[model samples]
Target: MSAVGPLDAALTVPAPAVVEPGAYARLRELVAGGGAVALTGAGMSTASGIPDYRGPDGTRRVQPMQHGEFVGSAAARQRYWARAYVGWTRFASARPNPAHRAVADLERLGLVRHVITQNVDGLHQQAGSHRVLELHGTLDRVVCLDCGEVTTRDQVQEWLADANPGFLVAVDATSPVRPDGDVALPEAQVQAFRPPLCLVCGRDRLKPDVVFFGGSVDKGVVERAYTFVEQARVLLVLGSSLQVMSGYRFVRRAAREGIPVAVVTRGGTRGDAETTVGVDALVGDVLPALVADLRG
Candidate 1:
């Protein structure tokens, strides 16, 4: 698992330097020499119509739902289910962007060894990446709070549709969608909405099997990421600010191992101190360009 250990707390990262796109070519050269392990963040999916959790300045605009809140309160669960029900259309419809496709192609070209993403969105897998490790859990599955029976979110979505037919149309579809399939809604409406309960137990809660802000990642997942890191010749970070250290710690480990760490993201990263080369350009644009340059 990850040498970074389980995520314990958030870190205070300074605003990162934004450099001109002078190093993308060099980044490609480094990867061409040896395959790199990618640790991706939310920014990788911004091109796929998904909003990032933070802005360029590295500050979150909105507070995400907390694990304790979701588990402790019925109202919190209702609010999450309602926003998720509406946001599922946008989230599910998002296709893999060029960055995702480029990552998959790089692996095919023997330049990428593995992909570990902080994003719950399955864009990387959708783009045909086989060796993917989701650092945070995915939204595609929901788990029972009592019996831990994991069920597909698509199946849950269908049940939701049957239970709440016109509710989706009633809510404004365009309301800002969050990174985790949550849309902003008035508190009253959220509380008023009825969400589905566990089918197996009949009276228990069902939660998306994701590592919430206040939750911990599965240790087994972290260990597998560590194994990937140990085998990688280099570490590549794409589209993440690295505000949290779960992703950053791998970069630190790579640095400790004396391997090169290449970064291609828009904003400041906590791992900037350890980065060997960084390209502050749009990842979608840079990744495709990297692939094309490799072709020549």
Candidate 2:
């Protein structure tokens, strides 16, 4: 493969210095000497067409909905499902790109011991990474609000379609595609699509099994991830901005423990000051190069 240029060479050239050509050599040395952990974020999957939540042209490409709106208003829920029903296929259809596969390869080579990811897309697992901890929940599954039953998102969509025949037709006919949902349809037209209830308990309330902006990650999940970090000699961060604490805390913990940190991502990161090595490059391009250099 051809070498790709730095993602933000203008910003990366001066700070902390570009990830030294020898950084991968050093990482390999550490891995050969002991175990290593990977802390991944949304950037890992951006090449696969899953937009970053906060990118300049991301989900906000359209309007954004708040957590309170989704939880409090029946109309809001209907609108969310209406849009999701159309976009769900696209989101679900996203495949793991080279970056994801590279991480899995690193694990198979014994260079990566654990993967802690903030993305709810489940791309790591799709990429064949076995020992992964999802800091945020996955969108592939849905959880019941009242009964705690979990179901595949496909099933929920089917139920929703059955519950609201011609409802999607209305949105398809008039709603404008927005990151939040179809806003072009009249409010009443959009509100006509009702989400299905939990199948196990027959309650008409189910939510995606993911942590929204204002939601907290499950404590057990966080503890398990910390345990993975505790066992590693180095922490590798890829494709993350570390904007949210859910993913940022691990970087903080690693810094506090004096673990050597290597970051590979596009644009700026919150943990740049804390990282021992920072590579401002696209993961799809840089990860394979770094892994190859490590092998040599």
Candidate 3:
């Protein structure tokens, strides 16, 4: 596989190194002959307005709250909800983009068996892909660490708004800007904002149903994805740099098992050397073309 950057002169000088018009045809040829799977990351959803957590920029945005911090202190919980309250609307209102629809089309054509995604956004399901396995849990849901009660994140947002009316009012009056539900607010205002307690237990603690940096996903989820890989002939990775172990491990696993891996991303990936085929292109542009070729 080529270790080319998006702007590498060799790839971009004359023309882009896009998959031929027969790209999807090639994909179908591979699939009909054997099993197929897709592994996706944040780039797939960037068209929908979500920023890539770690891209070429190398900026590490701080999460709203850590499990250890939220559980240990009341002030931490308040700060979390204050930011989340302002940010939830952007996340909830984001519509799936063309790249999402392209994957669903592939699934409909029976070429894609299962989708393993590192994104917490539920865009794939929203686009009508059924057999999706979320390696990182969905951000649209909330889980109580104490009682294990699961609820939609929308409901949690409502509770947060009610508990912190002042904060909500301030957020509404502002520019309505949000980045992955972590809007930029003044430290003084955020410090003044309070977090909502769990509706069931009435405790000032609740966490989103997402895996954090130091968090470990359930072994069962990992095993299920591995099962998909084991039954598949090819693993197509999309829109991920694979900087994190969660997504990188799958690429390594496929290579070890002799399965061909195809990657489509705008930037360098951690496992580029191990990939069988790497296409450095926007996922939105490449996916639809690939799907069209498959149908042709």
State which candidate has the highest TM-score: 1
TM per candidate comes to 0.91, 0.82, 0.85
Error of 2 at 275 (Å): 0.9
Tens digits of per-residue lDDT for model 2, 1-296: 12222232222222223455555444444544437799998789878877666662222343455667777776666677767776676677789999999898788777788999888788899999999988878877888778899989888888878887876555554333342222345566666666677668986667788777677789999999998987788899988888778888989999999898888787778887898877666788777655554444
Q: Could you tell me how far off, in angstroms, the CA of residue 82 lies in candidate 3 after the best superposition?
A: 1.2
Top lDDT model:
1
Candidates' C-alpha lDDT: 0.83, 0.73, 0.74
Error of 1 at 194 (Å): 1.1
List the pairs of residues colliding in candidate 1. 1-222, 1-223, 1-224, 2-222, 2-223
Task: Report the candidate with higher TM-score, 1 versus 3.
Answer: 1
lDDT of 1 at 179: 79
Off by over 4 Å in 1: 1-22
Candidate 1 vs 3: which has more lDDT:
1
**Runs in model 3 with CA error above 4 Å?**
1-34, 57-67, 172-180
**What lDDT is obtained when candidate 3 is compared to the true structure?**
0.74
* Candidate 1 minimal-lDDT segment of 10 residues: 1-10
lDDT of 3 at 144: 82
> Where is the poorest 10-residue window by lDDT in model 3?
1-10
Which RMSD values do the candidates have, in order? 8.0, 6.3, 6.2
